[model samples]
Target: MLPVVNNLTLKNYSHLANSDEVSFDVVIPSLPGFGFSSPTPKNWTIDDTARVFNTLMQEVLGYDTYAVHGSDWGAFIGWSLYNSYPKSVRATHMALFPELPLQPEQLEAENITLSKEDAFSEQLWVDNSVGGSAYAVQQRTKPNTIGLALYDNPVGQLAWIAEKYISWSDPRRGTGPSVLNDHEILRVVSLYYLTQSFISAAYIYNQNPSSFAIPLSKAKTDAPFLFSNFKYDTFFIPEQIIRPLTNLVYYKSWDFGGHFCGLDNPPALVQGLREIKKYWHY
Candidate 1:
């Protein structure tokens, strides 16, 4: 999901532009309690947001069906949308699928072998779980603590969000200078500071603590699924594991880009979505 400070239209993925055969009317909405949207009631989760968005497309916008694409939190909500309203959401595309890797014991029991890429991805996951994910833990358990701390301090907020933007992006773009300029970063930070919505945005982690939990059933959605694995992303799930989880129609791995594909490599991100259009059924 785009952060609270980031609106849906902020990133320009030019590859989503209309073509003779395909055209897209993108509807970019802020998550509840984020950006200009009102705060969610206590205990709201991704599922709740999905329901609201479904209504927006079906009832409000007067569409009988729709398709969805998401990264990060948006991916979680996309899963919920596909699961909860199978008939309404026709297809799904995602940059990040929040599924844990097979445990070492499970891999051993299955006699699974890892490729060079898979091994690297596995190591990154292990490293992040050990320390790189401290921010997630804090947001999950004590959102208000950090929220209150960074709420009014723009510098503090910048440092908090900017770090992720830098670390989670392609090394080429994230290092030395960022793909996003200081002005852009400031704009995002200012949105949270002026609106004081960072608190509720951070609360999403607390509300959905089970987000990281591995699915009990690997087969989660029957809807067609498309996934793009960017090299520098936090972790990359092997196709062997992903194949069982959904009707994975297309999967591609890039040598560049990272967690923030929309910013780091907008064309590639948009191209991935365009590829999904081939499998999308009305």
Candidate 2:
């Protein structure tokens, strides 16, 4: 993965590790302010994260070109990376579309009705102070306070992150049963707790520009992209939101899985990747 803003680690990528067909070396770096990575000198936004990731890929990793995959914040960074360095990204895929909205007409044409799930997501956007991120509300409005609380309390960190993971996953997709194994969820959760990366990961929300207003960064991405739709993610991107973006050749809708599809539905996740690979040479 590019850098994990969340508490997740390379070890959590066991799904990829066990795949015999995919022979890929993984590089899991902690984003600045997360894990072992040093904190940024000052507050950083998504753009800053993208710039730092670009440098990591080009100068630090000496990677001229590479394929990238992202979930949650990772997906945001991946899109930004592709936007910032199109030539450097061979191919990119994301499990969920961010909070970017579509034109009113587009939303209407799709007949996209906001279901109860969508309403929940909308509330998150509406309630957000600067824009739409519960984490951002906490971070931007009160960073030091929240950070200090979670700094040493391991339980606080787990609860904060676990809630996100649970909420981000689609509740309709049998979140409590069929979709993701509790052991699997706990594995990733434990990783976060052990690392004490909760506050740092949550800080990503605070640092990034609020989602109430979409950033101009969307225009920066021109590389091949995939938007894997899950039943219940933190935000719902009706097909209309995605239709306008050019260079998006692959769009797959999963009957199962949620925001964290890579973990909740690995088989489906792998299938999505395989389909993308059919066209994307990487």
Candidate 3:
């Protein structure tokens, strides 16, 4: 599930009229080399994470099948579970598209016309590709260099994560100027710094070179794929382009929210995730 402010699983999913806890149990693992999780081999990637999570759900947790939800890299992980283990994953709801997102220039070259909304979405994708991918490259190419550089420097690490949170999130909010404020960004930075996971977390980009390039033919699955596209998230592959990627059973687009839709728009994220429950069989 996408991480909410304070692990609001039952609250967002909502429990019984009187009960405080949500009916179903919530399982949120710290991905390998993330948060409090242990270190991982240098070869570990999103697929590795997915396989491990599959085992966790089936072997350790003893769940026959479960609903899946994620955003950003979490989107890639969610898709991997559905693609690799269809029978084990009942359904998936994602806030971002997993495949290599289509570029505006690519669409233009193909003579494809997009609506105004789609146009803006593609533009944001292009802008992010230009300005926002530096951290990805830095982490992917030489994680240790930066990781150690900022290992003892909490302030530096804060800037690293805070920059993305500021630039990527939808600045529009009903209650505030930005979806994520100083406190929210600091929470993640503090976790990374205190846990001393700065370097380990960066290894994901290094390990997952094929995160976005996976071909649609290889992504087939029996379980339904539910997509929730938020405007500011920089993933805006059109529906026609997305339909061929998997068993895309459901798709919803929002005018607001950002990469962290759970934080940017909690209610919408909950609604999108809850949709998969209807498709669940076990």
Candidate 4:
């Protein structure tokens, strides 16, 4: 779910603003059925959540327009919000671009040689697809099975989530152990166990299995689009491939950090957001 919880609160934005006169009204909602929002309704997909979020901004918060940013499932929901309400969502920034890998036919059609960075990124994707996606496959296809197995078993839940926290982080953060300490891992695992949300959280994969599929017609948005790809993230979408999927306002690549950039490199994440803010017209 959410990144290191402390990193997302409004206080973090104060540091992000620095000397700028920028002020933010941050609204971080728990995804339906995760954390405090339990009992995720049947058929609640990313699109459904996106609609609800839009309503929250427009109606509840009384903001006519707002910018959106996300990573992981939040990235999917952010795109859905932009796509569904382009006028309301003024700009969009994401740390992860969720497009699926290009098909062989598509790659052949381009016939462009990959840069060294692109090549390495591609190899990483291939490796993860082959070896590291078993958990994802299970979540997508049989969430209930694993959910039931882990629901009451705190140790099992801890092991399952902690593995990702270890493996998905930048290896440089550790010499012999993971950057995430046992306490941090236990905090998240405890939240899941206490809330009884571990089961429903996995259902997100089942609800949006085709989330990575890029729209055939380009899925262009009027909102200014930006993304930052940190080196150790699970996948990378090259600039050439990403351009058609977004409005393509800004793009940056970081040599450090990983999937959980908010935790692994909070200042860098904040800096990227600040950069995106420069292009925010609304």
Candidate 5:
């Protein structure tokens, strides 16, 4: 079973969705403020999101033990879920792991390929930090100001997110606007629009009140994990960072594709899921 943003539905794992090969039921619930689920009364944090999911799993789903797989924002949710109920979650697979301090070897590796452009790009975020922090400055600090402006205006939102999706996927590459298919990107974003979570989603920037906010911690999960990296991704995490964190069940380094592998390269995404199912059965 999987929890998903409202509006965007989960199609069963391609080949295995309806096949007799895998009998386990796959459930994808709409998250609060995104789909059928109700919007949260207050700005929600990753911890708060995890708590709701835990309740849904234990009380509604009636599952005492299960596996978890998360990608994008879902990756953080899965981590929080695993931490909150270690005994219940048997294994977890996160496609994008969170930020973490570089090991000595990692720093050495990062230093080896510091091209002029890379250095300039790295320097831009050096002061504020990477990924979430930069995003927080915009979303947490000035949400309403931005949200009021973007609401109902779809084109603005599309371009705003599209650039990041394209840039972060691999800005260096001459990839067009987005790697993911147009439809999939809209499907994911529509959840926010339909549920009026646009402001709420932005609000998550401010309410980062939880242990999960940190990059590294002693709070570890016994569940195994897997990561698939497309070499062109804007944010490349060295194997060194991932290998130490979990039971790395699988790692595939593809020569092509970007951050949105599922959209950019559907066949590859399908194959990846197939491989995971095989591993799950094995």
Candidate 6:
């Protein structure tokens, strides 16, 4: 399945794009293979997507400098843009910055003391690693196998993706209306199946195995970076932990959003993105 996390960003957060206060033009790519965008070559990595995206901005669109934002695997691709072409990419904002969560054993090995909320996030990481990531494993190893299986079976595809939307999001369904309701989930699945991009979307995992195991050493950057941490999100490594390793200029947290920050809390997402303008020269 595709990173529904990115799908949420594509569908929601119109406040940033539509706001009169935000003066910049918004260009959101369908990201290689999520919906209408064609799937990349089997060997293509996230960096390839970044390279083409940069070309689209600087050459095709005739923009000298720009800012970027993303979540989920989109964050990985966004990181590639900032790391490889920081001069062109003036600033970076991410709902989910590319921070690899320490495994339970590694956490114990480090013997780090964290705040209660941060510790809870670390525990969530441990739990998700064991149970919430089987789909990722299957997709990473056998995209085609499952892709073919679900290509024509729209119901199967919908079910496969809906589970992720339900679980990864913040836990607040019974109390009130969910930010992403049934209609939203159905919308994403329908788009995937209708475009026949269901199979190709899964290839992102198989093609970019490096995303899941990204080394902290690669987090270094000279360009301004903003991270919006949603406390209820799947895996959150605290700012204090990540600040020393990178050029993390801004870090904010909220209890509202989850993996789908754009959908869960668009205002917060918009605010974080706008905050990057302070550092961006253009």
TM-score of each: 0.87, 0.74, 0.89, 0.87, 0.72, 0.87
lDDT of 1 by residue, 1-282 (tens): 232213233344464345323556678898887888888999999989999999999999998888888888998898888777888888888888866656656666867777776676666666766768889999999999999998888889889998887776676873332345456567778888888889989989999999878473554457788888877787667777777778889988876777777766666676677776687777
User: What are the lDDT figures for the candidates, one per model?
Assistant: 0.77, 0.62, 0.78, 0.77, 0.58, 0.78
Residue 91, candidate 5: C-alpha displacement in angstroms:
1.5
Candidate 6 collision pairs: none
lDDT of 4 by residue, 89-141 (tens): 98887888766766435665987566676666666667777788899899999
Query: What is the C-alpha local distance difference test score of candidate 3?
Result: 0.78
Model 4 segments more than 4 A misplaced: 1-18, 103-109, 174-179, 213-216
Clashing residue pairs, backbone N/CA/C < 3 A, model 1: 1-73, 1-74
Window of ten residues with lowest summed lDDT in model 6: 1-10
Poorly placed runs, candidate 2 (over 4 Å): 1-22, 101-106, 109-135, 171-179, 184-186, 215-222
Query: Per-residue lDDT for 1-282 in model 2, tens only?
Result: 112212122344667566533434455567777766766655677668778877787799898877667776777777677667777876777776655654435556867766664555544433332342556566767777887887787677667667767766666543433445556566666766666666666667666756445743344556677777766554556555665664777877666666677666666666556554554554
**What C-alpha lDDT, on a 0 to 100 scale, does residue 266 get in candidate 4?**
65
Q: Candidate 1: where are CA atoms >4 Å away?
A: 1-21, 103-110, 174-178, 181-183, 214-221
Error of 3 at 169 (Å): 0.6
lDDT accuracy of residue 272 in candidate 6: 83
14-121, model 6: which lDDT tens digit per residue?
654664344456787898987878878759999899999999999999999988898998888888888889688888988876768876566667666677777777
For model 3, state the Cα shift of residue 248 in Å: 1.9
lDDT of 3 by residue, 1-282 (tens): 244524344444444456533445668888889899998985877888999999999999999998788777888898888788888887888887777777767787867788888788888888888887888889888888998999999989988888888788787743442346677788879999999988898888888877777655646577777888888887678877766776778888888788877777777776676666667676
TM-score-better candidate, 1 vs 4: 4
- Pick by TM-score: which candidate is best? 3
lDDT of candidate model 1 versus the reference: 0.77
